[model samples]
Target chain A: GQQVMQIPQYQHVQEGEDFTTYCNSSTTLSNIQWYKQRPGGHPVFLIQLVKSGEVKKQKRLTFQFGEAKKNSSLHITATQTTDVGTYFCAISFGNEKLTFGTGTRLTIIP
Target chain B: DAGITQSPRHKVTETGTPVTLRCHQTENHRYMYWYRQDPGHGLRLIHYSYGVKDTDKGEVSDGYSVSRSKTEDFLLTLESATSSQTSVYFCAIRVTGTETQYFGPGTRLLVL
Candidate 1:
């Protein structure tokens, strides 16, 4: 089984500030997926990075996959109040089931 | 959002009772999954099904069992529920030809 660790179990930032969360793995991954779960809601898929050193952006959010394919990051610029939620990175070693990171909880102060 | 629905959005039951949660999806995806979300633990996979009557256990499979009778239906059963099993349950479906998973609204269960 693969283990993925996410940094900063919890984070709080003033609205309009920047926020970033990192997900690290001990071994190379086939692919990595990011998800966001609002308070009292189910997780929603945000994005997926499959190639080494891949970077993708959606609006103000940027996602990066390390060249080694063992790490990934999500950065939000000028975050809005809607950005408040828990961010999780998921990986599947060689199976259909996914192993999720502990996740980083983000709070926005409006 | 995917056409995934979970039955009994919320439930309250006593210990030692058998509880079953149903996951229905109209997407007709071949792969379906069951996960439990807690405070510190993000989402732990309990079970998943690749096709009808084809299922496998996950990291946290103990005390839980699953069955996929049809392509669109997956069921998770707790033979004897415990207080520790009281958590938010989510059902997800993986799109064909891709690894993307769409989750249902989720089921909140409380065991006393």
Candidate 2:
């Protein structure tokens, strides 16, 4: 009964440009996880944000959780060609199952 | 890199056929999950197993079933596959005491 909606279903940017994807949930979340799926590859766990208003960064990628814990965002600075893939935001409501967002497919122009 | 492997990386079958996908893990995790990925629908959970012989349905479990007979093996079966079942299926395992889930390589099934 939970829904996660992601914005900019598909995005294409120049090789050196930046990109951002937003994830909004209908209800507050206990925790949110970000995953990256490369072309022809499986989804890999990137990071998890449990505390409200938390921010985490990995290399050029930055992840932020909204203060209300109902939304999150992933921003990539100076994207590279290798950054082409779909980024998904997943949330769990104290259960074993995770509800994933529709996902944002990112493409980088070389 | 969780030592998770899926059998038959790619499969093509006809409608109404019975198909089964296997997920093998070396981590011996307690929780296993099966999810289907479509074009617009990111990853919809089909089923998940908490332990051996303990399973539950998920958001999209109508036509899919799963079994975890052993701690390292999980199987997803499609009794009567349909064209709508043509999609990539991913199997994941949740690390003990953590919410992080590691996914397998995935199985691409095409129902014609």
Write model 1 residue lDDT over B1-72, tens digit each, in one string.
779999899999999999999999997899999999999999999999999999999889999999998899
Q: Which 10-residue span in candidate 1 chain B carries the lowest summed lDDT?
A: B93-102
Model 1 lDDT, residue B52, Cα: 99
DockQ of 2: 0.93
Error of 2 at A47 (Å): 0.4
- The whole-model C-alpha lDDT of candidate 1 against the native structure comes to 0.95
Q: Judged by DockQ, which candidate is best?
A: 2
lDDT of 2 by residue, B1-112 (tens): 7999999899999999999999999988999999999999999999999999999999899988888899999999999999999999999999999989999999999999
Give the C-alpha lDDT of model 2: 0.95
- Lowest summed lDDT across 10 adjacent residues in model 2 chain A is found at A94-103
What is candidate 1's lDDT per residue for A1-110, written digit by digit as tens?
77999998999999999999999999999999999999988899999999999999999999999999999999999989999999999998657878999999999999
Residue A83, candidate 2: Cα error in Å is 0.9
Cα lDDT of all candidates, in order? 0.95, 0.95
After superposition, which runs of candidate 1 have C-alpha atoms over 4 Å from their true positions? none
